[model samples]
Target: MATSTASYTQNQSILDALSRCIAACEMCADACLHEENVKMMVPCIRLDRDCADICRLTAAFIARGSDHAKHVLKECIEICRKCADECGKHEHEHCQQCAAACRACVEACQQYAGQA
Candidate 1:
């Protein structure tokens, strides 16, 4: 039997959030590298990359309806929160935007976890 379309459709919100978070994180990391005091943004850049990777993995797991999706989402939530915290410490527009995206992704992951 074919997999239900509902399986993929149900995760659309999280998928969208993950995509946004990935974009924001990549942009933020690149922007941070160009900052005057790049040394100060190391933590933020690291977290952004970490968060983006985890979000991508989680999105993949959820999209395939993998049994590991919930487990990966737990990690995604943690990393997203950490990334947001690090980005929140920065004053740059890209960092702020990335922080917002991380926060949104965290919320979406949590909601999906609850439903799963």
Candidate 2:
């Protein structure tokens, strides 16, 4: 269910990926909060929040065509990978969905970051 950003500039794909990752992370964090064993989900929740925040910053940098956007994208890919791995460890549907989105963002960012 990846969204198409073909009409946008090449870097726009990275923005689209970040947007998806942010939404997914937010949803996953909320879902983790509602889990019966909330204590067990602390790491996942923290990662999700961190990932979302980073993704937001990365997207803003990219949107503004800042020189530092490349560095941000590199950092973003790392956080996205960590968030995806953490979410993948959970059985919740939202976690699973978030993991997929994070992974997608990782790939997109990595691809664009290389060109940056």
**Predicted model with the maximum TM-score:** 1
CA RMSD (A), model 2: 4.6
- Candidate 2 runs further than 4 Å off: 1-8
Worst 10 residues of 2 by lDDT: 1-10
Cα lDDT tens digits, model 1, 1-116, are 24466556668988999999999999999999999999999999899999989988998998888998888999999999999999998889999999999999999888888878
- For residues 2-115, could you state the per-residue lDDT of candidate 2 as single tens digits? 333542567678888999999999999999999999999999999999999999999999888798988888889899999999999998999999999999999999888776
- Give the lDDT of residue 70 in candidate 2: 83
Off by over 4 Å in 1: 1-6
Per-model TM-score, in order, reads 0.94, 0.91
lDDT of 1: 0.92
